[model samples]
Target: MREPVDARRTRILAVVHARGAVKVSALASELEVSMVTLRRDVEELARTGMLRRGHGVVRPMGDTGPTTVPAARGDEPVGEGAAVGLVVPERHSYLYETLHGARTALEEAGARITLHIAPQMAGAERPQVERALAAGVHGLLIAPRWRSAAGEEADYGWLAEVGVPTVMMERRPRPGSVLHAMDTVCSDHWYGIHLAVDHLISLGHRRLVLAARNDSPTARSIRAAFAEIAAARPEVEEWSVVLSSPNAGPGEPGTLEEAPDLTAHLRERGVTGAVLHGDEDALMLVQRLTENGIGVPRDCSVVAYDDVVAALASTSLTAVAPPRAEIGRAAAELLLYRLGRPTGTTGPVRRTELLPRLEVRGSTRALLRPAD
Candidate 1:
């Protein structure tokens, strides 16, 4: 009953070849389909070098083969200057550093990089990705948005249908689910949690709390790792405080108006150490605790997960720094490797996991107790 994907794509190419140049709307009307579906087919065809795309029209690739608009120029063959698309959620410091690393690697490989920013919403990335594919990118590096736990099983069937080699950046399918069969480069978040917990326990912290955003994927990983480690050490007391509200503003997740009184909560739970999932949250918590006359590193030791703001904070934070640049470089290398290989010749799915390093600063110290 449903039309086959290849069949639809074939029809699109036929139409494009016949007309030389066809507007997306006209094609949709001719095929009796919605513009979204038509555009998807066109994008796929363009990605495979079967067609080229302009503003809103599709054209058959010239006899010279697939046309690519390079981001930069260099003394290399046209194929060596192939363009690669990178789609990320936002242009934050961590992501920017990652992009820089990717750019460095791509340049070395004589490839050009094009960037697209996808909004942090469900299904919003599809359009941006389609646009990149239509622009004739040789490959793609993407950090897809997984908006909710219910949508964790989202698949990349569309990506495969497009026939472009893609490498996921710092993201992966949920555990126990079938792997997405794509290359991936991500930080070892579970090990980062271990480093934080081990450091706290070694510093005489028996009672610990993990402060995190409940809806964040990274937070979920940290929480799971904390639970596993806590279960193994029954003598230690561990708890988690989840921030249920959305981020207050750009780069500010813990400054919500409805933020709970962490001082009172920590006092009641007898938490002597805390591992916050974000630098913003940890910095805010430290300020709040200081305002309440609690001395940091004296009354409580804090470790932030993301190191973005660790050194910037008034009291430099002991934090886990993810290998941001390395992730980018690795992702670029994987994508370029895929591009160099023949279609379907990539023997095995590649997955690279870089470890996060813990940086000790003034915010945390060995907890000293009065004479027993």
Candidate 2:
């Protein structure tokens, strides 16, 4: 036996009016329904002027004073606006492109976006988030800095406590942890690594090497996918080179010198194909190889991870281009959907992963045919 949708929602409104402001967790427990279900109901009621949602609590509409409630159902109408907060880690090139896409989508939906720029240090995002909340944002889109492997838990638990709908851009929950229950949209780095490996295998490359930056969050996924592929294809000999530090800033030379002689290492391992994590590392390796009289795609083929600096290289490199703008647009759309409905109930958590496109260029070619 089950209560009707309207009946359940009516009960929810009754509880809100009775309690003044009720915590979401408490309301969900009282209704004997999951938090997801309760959230959907609350969202719908808020849209129709029946209730108002604040950080972590629901209250009866107009209880505090006279107020104007935005219509819950309608297409994008001018002057009907909601404020959304966006937080990102600095103005990096990729992040800028992602922000552009988010802005475009928000504009199309008749929403206002407030930008918050935070540094890449841990705990630096909390103040920015507080500022957004104080500014009366209805929802949030955030890209948190990477946490160390040993960090006790996800640092964004405050998001759930605050009770506003949130979407994480380009971030995933730590492995084996369900601590944060928020929607997410990110590029599929694992799939991109698979594409890189498959492309190399198709080019008669049996001896392969993966040059990765150990500092990147996506490094784990890339390594896992590469190992899985290598294990399945036992004939391919694969090795890895992890850069100790991320690439140095512009005009900083001798960074590669600090690293081991990668050229000698690759030749010693008999690796004929290499998948480099960034264009900087790939180009640096290629320069060293050329100086050692090794010809790229003649004796060795190289594929880079990010397409940001791929074409700028002296020898254009084949690269995996993550759908940066697409990720932003998809994230913004998901947040808008959450705000528009609030209490919309679905079975599974909402997560969208966009695939990266392999941009083939002059850097990769088939091995020369062996003499019959």
Q: Could you report the Cα RMSD, in angstroms, for every candidate shown?
A: 14.6, 10.7
Which pairs of residues collide in candidate 1?
none
lDDT of each: 0.74, 0.73
Off by over 4 Å in 1: 1-79, 155-160, 176-179, 244-259
Tell me how candidate 1 scores on lDDT: 0.74
Judged by TM-score, which candidate is best? 1
Which ten-residue region of model 1 has the weakest summed lDDT? Answer: 70-79
My TM-score estimates for the predictions, one after another, are 0.73, 0.71
The stretch of ten residues in a row with the least summed lDDT in candidate 2 is: 248-257
Expressed as tens digits, the lDDT of each residue in 1-372 for candidate 1 is 899989888888888789777656457768887656776777788788888885455788873433433332232222245689998776355677788888888865557678998776666677888899899887898876554444445445465565677888778666545556677898889899889988998999988887776444566677788888866776576665555224621233343434466787789888888887677778887888999978788889999988988889888999999998889999998887777555556779887899999999988998888862
* Candidate with best lDDT: 1
Across 53-150, the per-residue lDDT of candidate 2 in tens digits comes to 86446889867832333434443211225788998877456667788888888875557789999876656678899999999887898876553433
TM-score of 1: 0.73
